[model samples]
Target: MSLPPWISEQLPENGRVNTKLTQRHVVETMYQSDRPFFSLQQIQQRLKPDVSKVTVRNRLDDLEDRGIVATDPLADSLTLYYIDHPESEWPLSPAGERALNRESAETGNPFREFLQHPLVNRVFREELLRSIAWAAIGLFGWAILVSSSGQLPATIWTVVGLPILTWASLTVGTIGVRLMTGNNLRVQSTEGLDTISLGGVVLGGFWAVFLIVVLDWSPLVTSGLYLFVTATYLVFYKRVIRPRFDASVED
Candidate 1:
């Protein structure tokens, strides 16, 4: 396959010419594909049979380091790679421009562009909204239970608090991971966040039990208070935090 002239121009002319050529081939293949993401094995299989998996892996790592590609943090076992933005990263040759224009014309989906915008890319805005919906459903169920029984069940707090707690933990854990990694917006692995979130759930459950048994607080009051806190947090996320992220992308 003929590579774009721009890609050939970027290749090194040193002793590592063959290696760079191979890497260029890998990149050109990724750039030409319609798929947004590809696993190591998939790329290797698509290319010449002689191309080794190690070669493909190394090339992908190099591309990612150069900000030409991005990977999914949630993907486990097999790492996925996708072009970040070829138009911005590389000076596109005429052929490359034609290919991109053709792909855009074929797809003809304006909404996809909005979804790919940096403001919406890294942040879990949709996930946050979904979590709120789940918590609301849980809250509705809790209310019905309280009305029918006239008292909170011992396990009612667990059911009512779990969604909000999970969402809270995920939000806090994501921020904590970003801070710890010094990325401030993105983290390499979500394992730390997941661990923190699980711990929060356990601690939250215990705290709810403590409030019920030791303080003699009504479960209704405790549950209402938890829901109230969650509502406040949701408002803050939508009004304050989300706008900041959106503004950052705009800038």
Candidate 2:
């Protein structure tokens, strides 16, 4: 029942941390655990000396009172707790839902809020695997087509057409999915596309083009490298950036 090293590392080494931090750790442990629910003693054991049993109990009561965690009382009178999702069987109260949304928006990171949106979650949850498969297939076909074409034209297309097509497809396709699902398309935050991010997007396209056309690299090789970089970024985001997001909750 020991806490994971990553979770423990984020906490203080000395006396008690604040209740909200304790709550976040409790939520994070449940998130990382394979088990869906943990009893009070089980949660206390996992958290150990970093958070006292009394503090864990208080936080659990607060989370339950706020409807952020659902509970089941056993015949033995032990209560089990699990973090509540929006679609959980025991629905979150209107106030709970509002508070969750407010906390996310308060982070001032639109991309984060976009990730938290229920509609976005619903779309990705159902379609992500399928879309990934199709994307791979499409990329393979594009590589073959480019390989067979005239070198100059292929390079030009790879440099110009590919970026535009990719941008259009992702933007339109995401909006299309939401609209087709009978959901309103809400703009989460354009702040994500601030100068630095937009600059990176532009520079990335030019860099790929430079490698293919000026350096005389094959379109296939250039495209593959671009995809590899993209995949690496996604892996880094999921492994590193996401953990911080997961552990954060507004006090």
Candidate 3:
């Protein structure tokens, strides 16, 4: 398949024009095709059969290193490769280019680098809103239950603190889960959200029992503590942990 002119423009003029040409052909085939994922052999079969396996492997590695492609580890001991960015979007979209370039310069913080890209920021905001809505619903339901029992605290904490804490927890929890799973936040997926929701429910239930039934902390104190702890952790995550981890991972 013929590659786009822009693809060539994106590559460096480092006297590897032939290598770049071959890599461009592979990208074009993957981008233009309907298939979601391809094995190394499948990619080679589709390309000029004379191309050495080493060349194909090296090109695939290069694409992945550039964040243009991702690898999926399968259960059958075989790995599949596919474009990492959204299929509907071009791999070399302006936002992607900016992300790739920024990632190299901003080695200190991966999360910050991630937000610098418009597409990644958009996805993060959309998912964050969804998580906040879910948190609100959960808090509202809990409020209703406490009210029916006539044990609802007559304070702003129950009304305001709960929702805020839940929202923050869900958002942070989602990111933590993604980091644990080694999934890139740039490539949006629902699996992280699902995992967060399930974990939230279990943890929320335990927290409620401990705070209300066991410790019996006052509503105001609970709210103050929750806000303090959550804020502290978030600050640490954004300022310290994220940057440290981001620096550790290679681009």
The top-ranked prediction according to TM-score is 3
TM-score, per-candidate, Cα-based: 0.31, 0.31, 0.33
Tell me, by lDDT, which candidate is best.
3
| Ranking of all candidate structures by their lDDT, best first | 3, 2, 1
> Model 1 over residues 12-110: C-alpha lDDT tens digits?
322221242355677788877766678888888888888778777877777677666667654568676776655645444446667886786578666
- Model 2's alpha-carbon lDDT is 0.60
Candidate 2 C-alpha lDDT tens digits along 42-134: 887777556667788887776666656788787676777776665457544546545665674586677775565555555566455445645
Q: Please report, in order, the local distance difference test score of every candidate based on alpha carbons.
A: 0.59, 0.60, 0.62
For candidate 1, the 10 contiguous residues with the lowest summed lDDT are 12-21
Show where candidate 3 strays beyond 4 Å.
1-112, 179-251
| Model 1, global lDDT | 0.59
Runs in model 1 deviating more than 4 A are: 1-11, 14-21, 86-251
TM-score of 1: 0.31
